[model samples]
Target: MDMFEDDTPGNAPEFTVSELSGAVKRVVEGEFAHVRVRGEIGRVSFPRSGHVYMDLKDDRSVIAGVIWKGVASRLETRPEEGLEVVVTGRLTTFPGQSKYQLVIEDMAPAGMGALMAMLEKRKQMLAAEGLFEASRKKPLPFLPEVIGVVTSPSGAVIRDILHRLRDRFPRKVLIWPVAVQGKTCAPEVARGIAGFNAMTPGGALPRPDLIIVARGGGSLEDLWGFNEEIVARAAAASEIPLISAVGHETDTTLIDFVSDRRAPTPTAAAELAVPVRGELLAWVAEQGARLTRAQTQAVETRGRWLRDLSRALPRPETLTEGPKQRLDYLSDRLPNALRGLAQRRRVTLSERGALRPALLRGRLAEEGRRLEALSARLRPALDRAVTAKREALGYRSDRLSLRPISRDLARQKGDLAETLARLSRAGEADLRRRRDRLGAAERMRETLGYKATLRRGYVLVHDGEGQLLRSRDAAAAASGLRLEFADGNLELGEMPARPVEEGGDPAASKAPTPQKPAAKAPRKPAKDEPPSGQGSLF
Candidate 1:
């Protein structure tokens, strides 16, 4: 029978385009509801809706395929042109285009060996471009004020990282949530790294001093996103120091090679970002003590030198004593010497007058004239002698005077004393400053100690084996436990039950103010409980 032949006008079968298309869709979709197809991808395209459309083809046949946005986002590896892959999806028909296609739910490389080869090839290509060069790597910051984290927020990886950071040194963490292992992981992580670098420093949003791209331990297929070239390039080009912590210590990814630092795990990455506050404080205190000691020793040495120099210097009175004695002797002898000279001249004149009257008169006149001339010359000679002696005495007096020496010595002593005073003042000031710093550091250390926290109404619960309890479950399971209060400890048989109130509201049961524990006799252990070791609360 001819199926399309119209036998009669009234009895002819008719159908709308929608009815025909719906029938075809049902038949095609039912036949290939669930199937796996192996082919090389071709002409892959993404539209505004994020759906991936592509052609899957072999030498002899071709088929159209699509991955919806939600499913496409979850793919571990994205589809690439000419790449052989195995895709699992359901076959469906689009009524508008009158075509049949596979709606891909999942995809993977055709083989593990093929994927490895591709990864190695990509690594080689990136290496050739100097992306993995040692010179390209930047040094990680010793202390980062703001740390940027790229990871999945819902995963345990971020929580582990934050906990580790808090334990070491608390820092501001900016979390950029992204897929850690999927088709979108590479692009999202790359964007996150670049976004941190693009932020302006000291702006409304603090720029990260360090970036950590982290993911938990995963299989090679699951970690492949971190090995993508895009992620590697982004890490290499980051202005801020980048740390790649993609998997466990044994795992290595391409981004690890390109990053400035590679941490064995996400927690280790957080450790690398900042220094421990306690250790840093200890170091500062040590340095301050050393400085104070050095300055004090220097001041003491200088003071000793000044004392020795002062003892070696001559006194002003000792230097002037000789000149003063000579002046006194010269003053006492001058008048007696002049008197003896005048008496001898008078005796000579009397002897000449008694010789003759006429002749004596003439002789007396000549003698008187000669005596007068001699007297004139003698007086000048005496005066010159006195003047020469006076000048010599004056010269000696000037040379012996203590004023010049005292002035010079005083100036030198004043300068030395001033210098010493300044040095002493400076050393004392520096010592005081260093001591203050050391004290402050000690206070800070005490403040940050766990004992201080315990005093604030917190307690430390330890098991019978001396292991600290971290959770309520662990505390409940222990056979015997020690409860540490601020002042002392108590041995308990088991975890204490919470006290209830009449209203059944937990908040209504108020705890009494903490007080010093009173001394008490040791209680005998219960039948099921083990004896606990006794220790100080601290």
Candidate 2:
């Protein structure tokens, strides 16, 4: 009848402090094996071991809460001081601390409305700081040499982006893996953005010309981290142009406003980042053709003008007529001058003969002999001069004969050189174009392959016979299964039976209810596997 009867010291069974604590822990854990507690968080602390310790309090009572490192990392929303949250976990006593605490497994903000309100408040604060100002936004690069991505390494979002980039244009993508929608999401995303900006432009890790902050579509609560003030501020302060692709088209976050550009989806962000390589190559070819045509037309027009000017100029014969006439006049006067000299010499000889007969006769004989000798010398000299002149004329004629052919050869050589240069340029252009196309094709093949999909967190499930299992029912029915991940394969034993709910209606249970298979841990893609996406012109 008395509750204190068991407390009698003489009849009571003894227990050490350890046993008492252990018993208390078991009872408490069993009673609260699964519970959901809604309260405001306070005194939140993240220890060096990565566990979170916090106090969950209501208006009247406070409860100590603890999130293990793994569970804390998986929380959709972090337990922050002054944040209204709902946590699900089991309650157990920490014997050393002499207190009962909640071992939280999952946590989230109280409601979507509450999260949105918080998001709005943060947005307002960032706006006041001018982080969302249009003036602060940088223009996206027309062609980014390297694109930095802050996103989950294993998600459909990354795959979509890579695939889209490959379809449009390929660029070097540097991925900074982070939690997209969890307790560490904001900080990790912010860190990724900052880390990219911190890199040296041409260092071992090349700096990205553009940045993309991306995540898949989720509920407002799941996407709340993008609305955090830290993320917004980081995006605003980034030196590299950033594109925000937090969620679907309608799901806007603070990052969307602060980033240089906002894309409706991750794929859209990739599409905006670079130009299609094929199209760029085509454009280059078009411009080159236009240039060639313009040059050819200009050359033709100049040549026509030169021909017209040549026709309008005087002839070579007309230019040489004066010199020809002067030469002819000199030739005609030479014979008359020689005849006058001969007549003058004859008159002088007659006068000398009349002065003295014998003396004059002897003198005349001497004069005649001297004149004959002089004439002989003059004749030989004239013959030599004629021979020399003939040889000189032949030499000049021979030189003249070769001049035209040499000039023609020089002109042909110049034309050939110009042709060869043009051909070389064309060849280089073609080679460059082919190389770009080959690269694009290779990237396309990679992007379109199943390996890329696997890297995006998809797994191919196979039955014992190695046939692909498409449905959850098929997988559940299979005796043995194999899962092919991006990096490796996992062989699974028989599927476990689903536990029937107690006190449930049998008829209701008999109705076929579709069940989804549990998701497996994602594996990173093998290094040997090619990355997704085609190439674009930078």
Candidate 3:
């Protein structure tokens, strides 16, 4: 019956044990506003309302736990019986049932189990999303101008990426620095990727040819951000080809599953970013050697062809029948019949001996005569042959000139007319573009016009030659001029004269004021840098 004291065990108070338990719970609840309990889950139940009911137990005792529907639905993994759990909750007593229960705000399985459960849950979720599919992966571009990197700013991952990309091909690499761990990290990583995309000139992001999302080697928990659904979705949704390098060769993540390519390490990711510089150089050198060898081969082939051609052709003088005819007659006449042959031989021998002198004299005289005749005939024949050949060549050249080098020039003319028409159409299109640009410019000018401000209240004045008079010095001697106000413009009348003592008197002067000899303005130098404008002549 006493509030603070215990009575004898057998001769107990009239109140039930449940009543006492409820009373004790109420007292403890009033004493402690919030409490954290570590225990093993005894039993678990989920209801249609989305609430979770579980009993938290120790070796000797247990207490009821009520997880609200909203919080229960958000848990990555469901509570199971016999699992050790840590719960932050408030205690309250139910007076009607004379029982005590905990209303849990947040809960988690204790130690390694919690992490393993989370990892397994994430793996299942991403798997269900088909993030691991190979069909979704895109091909990496051969050459890229800008490559986006999502990683820690100060880490070796970024430095490795930069060095690798520069080594492979010197191109710009944009970095999207992000938090890679803790509760807020997944969202931050996701947002960083989106931010990189948003900075592009078009609605599309800079669209780096490749995205290298990398981090140094770490334990499974340390690389957990890459396993998050947010990060996985971000990688999957990226337009750029993504290479995920989350952990060591043994470790993998959901981001790796969704990425276009996966590398075992951060350095390997860099390797994926660009080709090896030494290999490229070696390839270029090999190509150069091949080209040189090819050229050398071509030259040798041409030289051999020339030698063969020289061997195959005959000399020019041997081409006609003049030498062959004389040789043939000598061969034929020397072998004739016997009787005639003897007489012919004797006569031929004597005759040949005697006739040699006469023949030489005759030949000399005939040669001289022939020479004289040739000399006499040479000028006219040469002139005639030359004139005939020249005339023939001229006629042929004229005929060739008259022939149409280009087939159907009339048709070409018609085609040219059509082309001109097409060009005219193209010119009209260009003119329309220019006109659009002019209209846009005019609209912009109107939009930014100072005249609008001038209409509010403004004035502009000009001298005789329409030069804007900016200062009182310009207005000093100027008389005939115009002034424009917001409303309208008016021409100015003759101004009053200056005092004679100040300079020259106007009205009292008898002769017309000698016009101050106007200084001739200097001529602009000609921009006659020759031949630079010719497109191909230079």
Candidate 4:
């Protein structure tokens, strides 16, 4: 057994370290170069030169790997520890260290089996944070001034978005390109969103008013980077509004859940950014038609206002001044009416004054004339009546006076005629007759006287009392006696004797005395006397 092991034909003899490394390098470059392998990543490091260094392994074995700066920068993501990946690179060996490893160029997810496990875990964490809630989503702006886009720079998604936006609305657009998948793809997407926000410090973007994250259609494992919590939270915290257009219609990511708006694809996301050009042009035409109608209505209002102003202006003089004309007419008529009334009153006053005085004076003069004529006519008749009464009285008085005187003259004439007739008839005889009558008358007168009676022989005797003796009884005896004879009276010397008583003394009584007797003439004797009639007998 020792002799066979030492003299081995199939196995070569032992050499220096450089010779061993030289052989492995030839094999790696020649035969097993440019191959793809599936493994999990472990022990990752990014050096200062921007190259990525890590290990690729399975549960049984491990391998070293390197990605250069230029190639790694072009990768969709960085490789990490414990991540399942598909690496596209060639096996290589370092001659200085005498080590054999992998030089990575490109990679992808390992498989559906590995990707599903990681996606399910990340989806649960986002759901717990409420990022998948429908309520957290924002509505898209109707008209945006700036629009944002996120995709690979060389992808068809960005070209399609620009074409649609320029045609619809010529507003601005901003781009933030990032890797959409692999180990470090979530962090790169988050950085792209953050960079877009940083360009607008005060929420004013230089490129977009709204943000859109976009990519072409892919499998669920390829879209896993958008489902990461870091990418979702970056989208949610963006000040600008976010729109997600990640993959195909069936693709739903955590970024889509937190975005302000979600579109089914990249083309649809462009439509949300602006309006349609054809519809906007039509709307402008309709507003022009409305402007024409308003102008016409304003003209009609002005015309009506002018018509009303014309009606309100002042009227003509002929229509408005009727009252003033009536006032002038009354003014002209008033004075004449007053003057006519005054003249009528003056005439009435004169007529009444003249008629009253004329009537009174005429009556007075007529009455005076009538009274004077009546007085003159009565004076002659009164004078005639008075003269007639006086003449009648004088005639009656003369008749009475003449009757007495004539009666007296007639008686005297009768007496004188009777005397004359007697004288003529017997002058002597008449004388004698007259003498005889006288003598007879003388005788009769003598008979009445005592002395003449004595001549006729008559005597008277008286008693002593001197009374003619009518009776003896009436004489006193003692009284003296008286005797009357035809021629004279005789006184007795003593009382005549009387009869007495016989016894008386006769001597003492009266004595008889002698007295001369009265002388008597011869008396005529009466026939009856006796012869002794010489003495008174008794």
Q: Name the top TM-score candidate.
A: 1
Over the stretch 336-444, how does candidate 4's per-residue lDDT look in tens digits?
A: 6545555565566566676676665565456445544554564455456545644654564454344554575587689899999888777978788899999999889
State which candidate, 1 or 2, has the greater TM-score.
Answer: 1
How well is each residue in 441-521 modelled by candidate 2, as lDDT tens digits? 999988977777888998878766666777667776786777778888787745554434667774665645566565553
Whichever of 1 and 4 has more TM-score, that candidate is 1
Q: Would you list the C-alpha lDDT of every candidate in the order shown?
A: 0.82, 0.80, 0.70, 0.72
lDDT of 3: 0.70
* Candidate numbers, best TM-score first, in rank order: 1, 2, 3, 4
Per-residue C-alpha lDDT of model 3 across residues 152-236, encoded as one tens digit per residue: 9988778877777667667777788887765556777888666665565443445577778888877766776777777888888
Q: Which candidate leads in lDDT?
A: 1
Question: What is the overall TM-score of model 3 with all chains considered together?
Answer: 0.44
Candidate 1 clashing pairs, residues 3+ apart or interchain: none
Q: Is candidate 1 or candidate 3 better by lDDT?
A: 1
Give RMSD to native, each candidate: 25.6, 33.9, 22.4, 80.7
TM-score of every candidate relative to the true structure = 0.48, 0.45, 0.44, 0.39
